[model samples]
Target: MAPRRLDLARFAGPTAEFARYLRTETVGGFVLLAATAAALLWANSPWHGAYEAVRDLRVGPHALHLDLTLAQWATDGLLAVFFFVVGLELKRELVIGELSRPRQALLPVAAALGGMIVPAGVALLVGRGAPGMEQAWAIPVATDIAFALGVLALAGTALPTTARVFLLGLAVVDDLGAILLIAVVFSTGIALLALGAVVVLAGLYWMLQRRRVTSPWLYVPIALATWVAMHEAGVHATIAGVLLGLLTRVRADPGESEAPAVRLEHRLQPWSAGLCVPLFALFAAGVPVNGEALRAVVTEPLGQAVAAGLILGKVVGIFGAVLLVVWLTPASRPRGLSWPDVLAVAMLGGVGFTVSLLMAELSLDGADVLTAKAAVLLASAVAALLAAALLVLRSRSHRRAGSRHTDG
Candidate 1:
């Protein structure tokens, strides 16, 4: 009898833990969204130059341009820390989070893949062989996990817990695809010496892991060195965080216990949720648009293509692909979410603020940068608004139906 009871309790564990995690994510989501909006207004107001000046001023050692503009440091530097958190999340998920079980993993993984492939295909078509247009290919592929999850959180008791979990899992996989896209597509020039140094550092990091050096301080210096080396190696420096994080040994086996990795993730969750992400949003989210910028968004090929890819491509590609998968594979639908709920969540997937902004900065140069940024702002804003509206509507309907059932 004791053994049977233990089995039942073990079955109940994930459901309860996930419920608590969903609540935490929902609250954190609200705070992140508010901070991001405040930053946008501050960056664009009459004090815009102050925003630009603060971000652009350099502050490192005399010999090192180590002091990048506030924006560059946020996007290229601090955001690497964000990616480190991402690496942790990815590792955790693969080992135990949604991906731990094949049945649970299929829907989100398939949905994420469809989300990525369709957007790239659409962007490439829109680019239409123009000069520099090819660089825009990866822009549509990112799903801003924070903003997407946050918007769902604010939908106010309408989104079911099941839908929320599915969205979070889907976003993680989508982000993984975006990371791969960056490492493979955006990197054009490679410095062999810098790459070699990065490899050597990675080896050292692995050795440290083997020796069980789990202290955060020991890894900090190594992380910074890896970032510098990767920056010099002509790969985006942020990839350093991803690689380093991949090497970090989690103390606990999530599969067996809430391992060391899970513990670290929980500890860092608030910092990432509160500070790193919000600050990064403030520095990276601003797109100061003028009359000229409006004209460019409408006229520039790259800007126009990006806007279409994100706004149109994301909604159609993600929802449509999920539907096709459901039809083709009877086994593929996500549990705990109805088709209507899934479609509503698909609209939410359209909120591509963080990753879209990062891609705009990296993919365009010269005068095009301004235009691309404007496009990203416009596209993301529209997507978020539309997605939120649909989700609110769906929730109302779901609530009414539940009430009717209760009354019956």
Candidate 2:
């Protein structure tokens, strides 16, 4: 008998969804790079002072203490849009995607946890005794999904589907960990009244979602109120986005084409990828590189820790965690996923661009912030290069093996 053909429908939902996600992220990665390049050029140009002026320009109602600079708006306000999408994706995965099954989810979750803890530990060790550096530990714990997926996309058909799924699951969990750190570690000056208002709004949102209220007008105001309340409560406003996203109903009603979460994610993905993320990159990635600034980035403890934590810490932590899990439970390793593949993905996990920049801004100030930003950019670039090289090799190896099997 001929070898039985593998059924495709069993994997259709997740595979198709992941493919769509990767395509959007790949395109967004190019846009993000262009924005970063423009920001750098503008910052270093003769009109650099004008760039700073634009970034520092304040707006909003001063009486409410809501007046914020252009850069602050980019980091705080625009990033919330990005996180909202993240929340949707996370909920979908938990409910119906790769993470729905405990066996399938365990490896990536373990990897994500290790990816976070080890980098933080390394950062803390590297920044030991340095004043004000403790807060910067979270900087390297992020993995920029767009950049990592874009690099993997470059491998084209040679890459394995299993590898892509693994990376996506790992990156999603990594983002979740980063968000938790932001909410718990970075928040300050708790305003109980404002927080209580946020809680009430969240409860209302959840009730509406459970009731299957799909009107955007009704939900939009609630989301805005929640965001404002969270901002006033000294928590990052983006946390509100995640909460709203999580509360979105993922299961579609009868005769519906898609769930509320899927519909919203599809509709908002373009805005998140094309506009929100790139715009944030434009504001966040522009660092005035001068001789003095370069020297500080090189010599500063904060900068060194961030760079080292991202490049070395992520690879060691993620890969080591995978090895440990596989050793402890041999059956836990997913079929067709190899050690080399895990290693390559671990390297990709070190590309902590978007969230890392946000964390640096929140954790440091003045020159330290600039130094940390520079370090994040440098580390992300290095990680991308390393990951790309490893993925290319792995792709070629897979292609050759496929040819041999087919010829047989």
Candidate 3:
């Protein structure tokens, strides 16, 4: 038989729509930044007691151990919605986007691995011999795509489209790594019976999609059941969102205008961006800043490690990985992207805002937790400012080069 042809047209519509979705998310990033600022201001203001009261207030069914504080619900529940969107995007990428081709996918995958490893290694080295500091190593291993993209958007239209694509791909892979870390590293007890139930529910969910069941009434309950089971199984409940999203059907039926996965992602994107993520930021980003906490963050090893890992480790890891890959396989670097472009993108990768905060909450508690959060906030801000400046300079250089070419 002759070589089989790949159906490239099958992915065109979804890919175009996904690009549009990313543009919308840039706007959401602004909203997210505002929410984070509000939380920080509220947490440190005179009304700090009220903010604490709201965050700690619990309302859920007691028998199910669901009566958690508002902050817990934000992380464990609302963040699941955000992860569901992430899952949908990841599934799309794996099936038809850039990741569909192994050659196209290699750069981002390798860079993400490097980005995560170097940061965690730096955190470990900095936190060496400090009690309870080792647990904070994962804090800087994530990249907040929203905030990074937002910074890019603010840099005007001079930035290369290739750069945006590269950053998006890298961040998605980084998220996959962080999710695995959350599942394996943070989970304490293994509740086998409940885990089995979760597996069963997951199977049922797969069956529902296979049958082309479009009713949310039927699927919602199963999704919720899976989430509850995962929580009870001592696994992170957000994994349920990711699993369900990945298992959803991505290809449309012959007569349909869109795939089920596309429809769900489009419908849920607003909720996830507008409410879920911002609300999580509101609760999670409210680290109280005071003289004592500020002093501790500057003096404490954990804080120093987390900050350094995010601000410096990301640059070294991502940029170094790109350089190594390009040097070993010269064909790996995409045309029109130079080393400076990679360096700027790598700098932006340090903005580990949202998921970094979540990991801090999961890994540390008490003064350490507060200190880690403060460090994350400061480090993320520094990274954003530095990335913004680098990106602006890069954009101006690109514009001037283009103008010179046109004049010639």
Better of 2 and 3 by TM-score: 3
Per-residue CA lDDT of model 1 for 67-112, tens digit only, reads 6776777777877877877887777677767877887887788778
Worst 10 residues of 2 by lDDT: 1-10
TM-score to native of every candidate shown: 0.86, 0.93, 0.93
Clashing pairs in 1: 55-70, 251-260, 252-259, 252-260
Instruction: Give residue 145's error in model 2 in angstroms.
Output: 0.5
The TM-score leader among the candidates is: 3
Candidate 1 or 2, higher TM-score? 2
Q: How many pairs collide in each candidate, listed in order?
A: 4, 0, 0
Residue clash pairs of candidate 2: none
Q: After superposition, how far is residue 46 of candidate 2 from its true place, in Å?
A: 0.9
Model 2 lDDT, residue 128, Cα: 79
- Candidates in order have lDDT scores of 0.73, 0.84, 0.85
Ranking by lDDT: 3, 2, 1
Model 1: residue 244 alpha-carbon error in angstroms: 2.3
